[model samples]
Target: MEREKIISDVRSKAGGCFQKGEFYCSEAVIHTLNEFLSWPFDRSIVRLAAGFPVGIGRSGCVCGAISGGVMALGMVYGRDPGNAMDSRMFPVAAELHDHIKKLYKSTCCRVITKDLVFNSPERKAHCVKITGEVAAWVADKLLNDEALKDKIQPVVV
Candidate 1:
């Protein structure tokens, strides 16, 4: 498939998952990538992101969507145990972080979500949309970035 289409699909799929309550924002981002990337991670690996929603248990230190997006990038570009962190990974993650920061003007969940209460319908809808946008942002960066794409392992399954 074309990379653009794949990225678009990632956005749609992530959004769908979040809106459906199939997963939390963080899980939705990483899980969608994992599914599209052929589960490069063990399915259970998604558990690592569960605590990240609502900004590390609602303290709101960082946007869980961005954190999860970066985690998705790590699964793709992170180094193995035998080596130092891959040179390409941090830059890609930074690009994603910068993109989100530039768009929303902040990376704190509380800042981004300040207008809406967690239990409100508006908050749920907005968060679902952010989940999709973040997934697309990261996936688009990775798929089009030859430096990172070339370094990724071929999908295992």
Candidate 2:
């Protein structure tokens, strides 16, 4: 129940999801976030992230982990129709973006995995690591930010 353990657990679950080949990078992130947030959105919401893996359908543009992290952020910070937008949305999303960029030097999957052969173990490991880190980063943000934390509904047993 410690804070660090909670964040690390989110990372492990996301990474394990990808490692088990049950979900791709983006789906793992959305799935983990949805679960951690107690199903605030339907599980089907993962479909929105399905197209993001392999850098937006394998064109290798933005990192799928980054894309999923943004979506995860949106789940909490996003606004509904006719409601005022949460001011924290853009900045928080940008923070995730910048965090990945700073660590990897690029948010492009192609760039990040450039040295590894496609579908090779190295590539899969790299993606799995990124997926876990991104999930952890999102978890840390959600757990630490008071405004964002307030948005989380209590989990129903």
Candidate 3:
């Protein structure tokens, strides 16, 4: 038996953006995906995820990174406003959400970070890692999911 390593800079790329204050957890996840995938979407698209940070405006609710990842998946597989919801996007969102929830053992930001203070150095580091990992996982989803690959932009490199 052999363990395989996934070679990817997306995690670090996302973490770097978060560490540099480029965006919050949710925003960083989508931004890094957009950057690496080189999608032609407008820069402002990341704004939609803005309210999700620190658990929906620090309310300590669902994880922002997961929220953002779901949005990113939508950007790729979602239906246009002109039509009803696509049958495809829901499953992708479900998979991403479930994986993220499992990884952190919960989706509530406060539950996950109850031991850390908001914006504290430790919190920043912890968030950077989590956000980056989420971004990378979403990237893998985009790159490998056969149903989505035909719909999404090709990876830049």
lDDT of each: 0.81, 0.88, 0.76
Clash list (residue pairs), candidate 1 = none
Better of 2 and 3 by TM-score: 2
lDDT per residue (tens digit) for residues 1-157 in model 2: 6787787788888888999998999999999988888788999999999999999999999999889999998998889999998999999998898899999999999999999999999999999999999998998888887755645432211
Error of 3 at 55 (Å): 0.6
The digit string of per-residue lDDT tens for model 3 on 50-140 reads 8999899989898888888888777777777699887768988888778877888887889889999877999989888888778778877
lDDT of 1: 0.81
| Model 3 misplaced stretches (Cα beyond 4 Å) | 1-7, 146-157
Candidate RMSDs in Å, in order, are: 3.3, 2.6, 3.7
Tens-digit per-residue lDDT, 1-157, candidate 1? 6666677788888888888888888998988888766677788877999989988877987988888998998887787789888788878888888888898898899999999987798998888888999988877766666655544322211
TM-score of every candidate: 0.88, 0.93, 0.84
> In model 1, how large is the Cα lDDT of residue 20?
84
Error of 2 at 108 (Å): 0.7
Winning model by TM-score: 2
Off by over 4 Å in 2: 147-157
Candidate 3 has a TM-score of 0.84
Among residues 3 or more apart in sequence or in different chains, the pairs in candidate 2 whose N, CA or C atoms overlap within 3 Å are: none
- Pairing residues by index, what is the TM-score of model 1? 0.88
Clashing pairs in 3: none
